[model samples]
Target: MNRMAALRQYQKVNSQAQTAVATPHRLVQMLMEAGLDRIAQAKGAIGRKDVAAKGVLIGKTIEIVGGLREGLDMEKQADALARVDNLYVYMMKRLAEANIKTDPRILDEVSGLLTTVKEGWDAIGDQQPA
Candidate 1:
């Protein structure tokens, strides 16, 4: 097989394996980490003046944030879920603003906010019965 085909095969198999093993909590943790990673990379791309890369990374961050928002359980706790939804929306807007303005500080703000959210989520996971 060609190198490109081999890489695609590997990725497909790896993704399947990950999905087979992932619990809902693990998936949420993965999404949060991915979002934070993308925002950090976008910040670096901004510093390097790589406009295209910055835009792409920031776009991924926005999508990841939106996905997280969609994952929230609206029926569980209305107030808390609404707050998280609002935070996710704010993060998405800030990510777009950062991409448009090429601002690292805005990415920093988003990253910090995500980190706090992740911490809270993890704490809840810890308190839950296995």
Candidate 2:
């Protein structure tokens, strides 16, 4: 195998190992981090006028947000979680718009929203034993 391909394989294995041992809270944290990273990369792709990369990155970010939404406890329809679910839906819509327009402002808006959510999650993590 080539050096870069081997490195990617190693990183994938390492990430899987970390996920296996991570607590539930940490898993959510990691997901949020990944979503934010994808959004940032998508914004960069927009700056570079890389339409293909922007589409793929935004798509990944949408999937990450969707996963986070799916993970929410919605059976009881708790007010707070319901609001988060709504926010995720909104983020996905904006992501689609951004992809079509190649707009960085929309990306920035989504990034800020996700960062706010992540900050709240991190605060909760600090209070919980993990």
Candidate 3:
């Protein structure tokens, strides 16, 4: 196989190994990190006027955010969590708008919001009992 393809296969195997041993909390962290990375990549695509890459990246980000929302236990929802659900919905909408408009600024807005959520989530993880 070519070098780039070989590298991708190695990365895929490594990621699968990590996922197999990951705690639920760590999985969520990974999802958020993936979303952030995709948003950054989408922004770069926009700068390059790479419409196809931008669409694909933003779509992946939307899927990641949806996964995060689904992971929430809305059946046992606290008020704060309900608001988080709403924020996720809002983020998805903005992401769609960003894709349609090819706007990097919208990606920036969504990235900031996701970062805020991630920071809070990380703080909660830090406070977890050992």
Q: TM-scores across all candidates?
A: 0.84, 0.85, 0.85
Where in model 3 is the C-alpha error above 4 Å? 1-17
Evaluated against the true structure, the overall lDDT of model 3 is 0.80
User: How far is 87's C-alpha from truth in model 2 (Å)?
Assistant: 0.4
* Angstrom error at residue 120, model 1: 0.8
Q: What's the distance in Å from true for residue 76, model 2?
A: 4.1
**Sort by lDDT, top down from the best:** 3, 2, 1
Candidate 1 global lDDT:
0.77
C-alpha RMSD by candidate, in order? 7.6, 7.5, 7.6
lDDT by residue for model 1 over 4-72, one digit each (tens)? 332232233223335335566766766777788888888889889999999888888887777777677
TM-score of 3: 0.85
Error (Å) of candidate 2 at residue 50 is 0.7
Note the Cα lDDT for every prediction shown. Answer: 0.77, 0.79, 0.80
TM-score of candidate 1 relative to the true fold: 0.84
